[model samples]
Target: MSPRFEPITGRYLNLTLLGRPHRLYIEEAGQGIPLLCLHTAGSDGRQYRGLLNDKRITDNYRVIVFDMPWHGKSSPPEGYQNEEYKLTSRGYIQMILEIAGALELDKPVVMGCSIGGRIVLYLAHQHAKRFRAIIGLESAAHVAPYYDVEWLHRPDVHGGEVSAGVVSGLIAPTAPDNHRWETLWHYLQSGPGIFKGDLHFYKVDGDIRGKIDEIDGRASNLYLLTGEYDYSCTSEGTLDIAKRTGAEAQIMKGLGHFPMSEDPQKFISYLLPVLEKIRGAA
Candidate 1:
């Protein structure tokens, strides 16, 4: 009997960024226009396994996903133990552009979820010409926190389980058990306080209410899709952003905060039309 092997290939790149040396893990499948996938906060590139394997999307796009430094197969920086790992908008933007440069991609289309979603807006506003297009899933400029993040990093708390528990409610009640648990599994494996650290950027540092007007949506070809069930990044907020920034927007039904991971099939159904529009424009 022949063993099964996925078309996906995983590799590591040695990158030194923000003045520190680090190793990054990346995966790719299919080929054509490069389509980069960014995972949600507290998770890793593994969240995109479904997208990489889906031929409908990959047949026309080179699907790429990477574990940010300190996430998934990517190890923390050389001296990570001594430092606090809070992510800042300045650092997040630099890391993304640097990764794109390192890969030598020719203006890849960027699609991001959650924190990944937030950065896509920044990319649009600051470097619209660098990408073919930007897609934000469960994205918004600013969302006031309903809970204290300190709970994700308490000395007595089991950070991983607690993080997963908090976000479990954010997934749609109808998400399949397999995908829902898989999404939470990523959070369950997160480094101590990494979830809390990433939120520092999402809830505080990366606020773009003032700067969103600067984005030329026509040039960036911005698309914003927020799940109807997502309390974290509400559909109302996304619609508001679409109105303010001239971005094409929609509210995904029967989905939640982690759309791509929680319900890839349904999410892809909606995503296919958007991809068609992007491809036609390209």
Candidate 2:
């Protein structure tokens, strides 16, 4: 069977950055403070479809979601030197800065999942004034664990095997079927090259746990959101990040890594108050 497309649409933004016509698939809607939404490494930014389209969040903020180069419908750059640029967090961050400037958004709030979560944390650490607030769902303090060679050297997989791997050892297998199956399926086949590059990027140039204090001092707001059952980022790990950085942290009860996809209504409930706090600060 063919893969399912997310039931969301906004704009197909194309802009020349670094002398290339990068295809940027963005979901921009509502009218308020700019909120840029990013997805995990293996999946396209469309992972944010549910949240970006929801009335509760969008009604209060001008939410924007976009796929990075080589993921989803966003075609990669021409003459792309995969080895030189693939999978580096720096390159992704550069694209993000350029994308934000192109959208005419100024220091918007950033929200991400998994790797997306990591990216926002990196930005908050390195470039705090660029964003109004930072929200990470199942975010991490470090990168080496997930991007190890053992996790990437595996052979290509079909949906069943991918689903099994995602539910095993990390998220609760008893989670909702459609949410579980779809989220796994989408990430499994997006692009192995891009995924592999991402792993390489983190392994070589990733370490933020030691610098949490530096990140906290610069950002206006930092929030950590994760599911109680999210073994991918253990409760201990998230708590350690929160404690060191002195940021408000939340662990959603009975949920797992994919809390936004698993239970968006509950996800939004946790998200709104934090966003309100940021807005009030502004």
Question: Top model by TM-score, which number?
Answer: 1
Candidate 1 TM-score to native: 0.98
Worst 10 residues of 2 by lDDT: 159-168
Off by over 4 Å in 2: 1-8, 80-85, 146-169, 217-219
- Which lDDT tens digits does candidate 1 get at residues 184-281? 99999999989999999999998998988787777799999999999988998898888888899999999999988999998998898999899998
Total backbone collisions for each predicted model? 0, 2
lDDT of 2 by residue, 9-91 (tens): 56778898656788777877666999988776556765566677687777778888888877788777776654434565676
